[model samples]
Target chain A: MYSSLIITNNIHSWVLSLMPAAVTGITEMMMIAMIYLTVFAVLGLFLVLMERKVAAWFQLRIGPNRVGFFGMFQTIADALKLLSKELTGTDKADKFLYNLAPYFLIISSLMALAVFPFSENLQAFDINIGIFFLIAISSIGVIGVLLGGWSSNNKFALIGAMRSGVQTISYELSVGLSLLTMILLTGSLQLSEIIEVQKSGWLIVQGHIPAVIAFMIYMISGTAETNRAPFDMVEAESELGAGFHTEYSGMKFAYFFLAEFINMFIIAAIGTTVFFGGWLSPFGITESIPWLGVFWFLLKAFALVFLMMWFRWTFPRLRVDQLLTLEWKYLLPINLFNIVLMAIIVWLNFTIQF
Target chain B: MSYFSDIYHGIQTLLTGMGVTGKYFLNSRKGAITQQYPDNRDTLKMFERFRGEVVMPHDENNEHSCTGCQKCEIACPNGSIEIIWDRQVDPETGKKKKMIDKHIYHFGMCTQCGLCVDACPSDAIKWAPNFENAVYDRSQLTRVLNKPGSKVRAGVE
Candidate 1:
């Protein structure tokens, strides 16, 4: 199944041929990682700006429009301000873990970004276990929250960090379960293979009810995993005054901040690839232009991103007990039942045939 | 028995809240409730009855209605208004006249309470609708209400 989807079987060999033997296989992977880290950082800035503008619109207010035309440079200005800030820490803070926290978050999300097959030939390191890798690596971000909160030596930060840890663990079940439901349809855990499985039709439209249920569960759990609003008790600014990252300042704080938007992008990107057919043009409409796959892929992902933002602005933050109840009593059970229902549907041969 | 129904209601209410916000977001053509303050300054008009600051209106002849009675100065709670006056003999009537030298208005101290406007005996001072009162220097905020070279309106006294 994976053999035919290997886009760079020759390309990898070609790179090895051209490069000096001293430069090992890790060198090629490192090069890919370095190039994409810069790309994702730039992409992170735009996502932050887009989230702010969406939040403003939902509240019937004009958001930042001063820095540049429609506040286009607002995030750029914010990045500059964060850069110039002095890095501050408490006198009693565990300085090592305190500083290491933000890097843990940023590196994990950046790793996930590399696995995204944006188009047929677009992805880097199309790992065999892409979905499994994404689920496993993305969960590591919560450690940063826990460490940042604990190391700050602040009570609220510790409470926030604990809540974040608990929330991520519980919701991780639902996110994995939801994706598993879709993985049932695709068979292969490889992302490109999953996208290929949707060649007949997008999963949401083809599988209908069970697929929609899975997508809905995926979105809610994804929102929780990213620690967005409503589920954002981790950094609930109103109560905790920015939670775990409260004591961080300067470009260090900016790392924690940018990683958040990047996490949101990763969730949206996975949502797009799994349910909306990755880079496969919808209904094969724009199939002629292969590169348009990237456009279609981003368009779908951003739409889901917009939906997540809508959930943020419209809903009130959930209380801790209520948040836990939402996961344990609601999403987890529903996701479990949804997986079984989907398997039954697949066995019954009732899914829409293209 | 009611457990499933409770979940349904919760989902329903959540969707309703989203619908209201979704309506506003889609109707963004109506624009946000926030007036882009700096951008819309030219077209942004205050209400006709809006009172911002007190000003003594003057005609092209540089004549105003203040009799230098200091009524407005007395009415000001914060002492934001001061009337500068001197006694000058009225040549025509052969009587001493209390003519205004200047009416110093410290906009920095003003609360826009309208007491000064209400207390002016000659109707010389009234509220100006314009309210953009920002200034770089504190001294620049103390304005001369009586324009330079302006005298009292001929028969206002």
Candidate 2:
């Protein structure tokens, strides 16, 4: 009876010891969130400026140099102007949902950042099913787009929402399938576990031919899923006059804009996590430095984002029919065959080293 | 066999298309070709017949040749011209003469049509190349051509 009492006391002390660590962790998480928000705001500003610069370069004109030095603060000035502008609601619209949609969109996209593993130990939540959680949460953002479109009561907006819904849902399957192949090979759903598997080498390098093929499929489908050009029929400026958020104005519109950029960052971050090995050093030399994973992860993600931007500015918008055909006919068949080929190759140990 | 050849043909066509872009990519770096407008204003080359804002030239004697004629105000299609008349006793003749009190021209509304300059019988007005007319206040944009003590040019007076 005395020995049992002593054991309970020890257990109590252990629990007491863990409390400080838990409190520290909570504080750390709060700090990280604040950082992420700050970074996201800054990134949005950078993207707006970069987009203007890129568009100007493409059109053979200089853009937005008068606001601040080299137009760096132009977006900030524009943001201030937009913030002060009155958000006018249309007369004939579903007032509640129209008001609510942008918030939902921004929230859904922001939630996606929770599961994304920046490095081995640097994740917000190391959920066992992190990959699935990310995919699921990111997909919820589409609901916001659809609601925004439908509630606006405008025909163009409704059509845009429909197009976005169809495109995003359809392309999500290909993105999932490509990711599924990676998950199958790694035999893990946890993002950190996936990175651990790729410690010896990146999945893109280790899995060889199939990995490259899967990567390509993921990129193509991911681009479509993000509603980027040339798959951006939903927001086709020429056809649908600002598209799904056509009736949205002021800060409500800003929320949608923020959501889009955040979504882009989320996809890029997930891609870095899944394929390139989140926080895993290339040569295993940087493993000692825990912070290096964050560096590498961001580098890879930004590279992917740059590629996406390049694709956006370079490619012309695809026709709706052409886009669907590309997905259903070409990408579907190619991905299916690639998956089968990957299965066979993995089973046979037929490695094609790049 | 024909299908395989078609694939090759498609690849060739794609490369050919990319070749055009590749050439332009190399050329874009050589010269930006973009006119940085505000920065390069000093070197901006406007044609001599560019037809900018109208200016009423002032003479050294603080005299203006304008006889308070309202022809230019009538000729203006947009009603952009406004001429205010001030009666003054002539120092030499000791007779009351109609003088243009103040030509308050709002260049913001001016189309640079040169109609006002053309209608001036005294030939005191000409087009000025001072195009840096952007102002923070809309009210301040309405400019008085003749200074308080200045006079119109001697050529027509």
- lDDT (tens digit, per residue) of candidate 2 on A239-318: 99989999988889988887787777777887888888877777777878777878998889888876676667666788
| Cα TM-score per model | 0.84, 0.71
Q: Chain B of model 2: TM-score?
A: 0.66
DockQ of 1: 0.58
Instruction: List TM-scores of chain B, every candidate.
Output: 0.76, 0.66
User: Which lDDT tens digits does candidate 1 get at residues A297-318?
Assistant: 8999899999999999999999
Regions of model 1 farther than 4 Å from truth: A1-24, A59-73, B29-51, B58-75, B82-104, B115-124, B132-140, B143-157
C-alpha lDDT of all candidate models, in order: 0.89, 0.77
